[model samples]
Target: MNENSHTMSERPHLRVVHGNPTDEEVAALVAVITTLNTRDTPAPPPPRSAWSDRRTLHRPPLPHGPNAWHTSTFPH
Candidate 1:
């Protein structure tokens, strides 16, 4: 009457279908199967933005017809 009652008396239909687990319900089902087979501690990657090392401004193309809106080769 050990080894889980000899595997529930050699699987009497798995012992009347699921009916025998009380060692504190097999220690709370082995603590929920060891917390669902552990493995969850990865979250630390987000902090690098000096405006993404700024560098991208080649503006120069807006002058074509009718005093191009009182143009002034922008660069005040």
Candidate 2:
């Protein structure tokens, strides 16, 4: 055997096996899948916030001119 060659015993052995489900098993599987598919329902809408009322959502107007900063009490 060459230096780079590997013996049959040293090589990895792999095998794949395929299966066929019986008719009854396939029908049961389909029934389960269909049940799962039909169980999904649309979620309910979220509740409205407390600030949803326009009357209670008031905010003071912002100051705008050069002297506006002097009129305002809040620090920049």
lDDT (Cα, tens digit) per residue for candidate 2, span 1-76 = 7775678777634222467777787678779878887788666889878878785666667688998877677743
Q: In model 1, how large is the Cα lDDT of residue 8?
A: 36
lDDT agreement with native, every candidate: 0.64, 0.70
Give the Cα error of residue 34 in candidate 2, in Å: 0.2
Number of clashing pairs, model 2?
A: 0
lDDT of 1 by residue, 45-73 (tens): 99978667555354567787988777856
What's model 2's TM-score?
0.31
Error of 2 at 70 (Å): 56
For all predicted structures, in order, the TM-scores are 0.24, 0.31
RMSD of each: 11.2, 12.0
Error of 1 at 66 (Å): 10
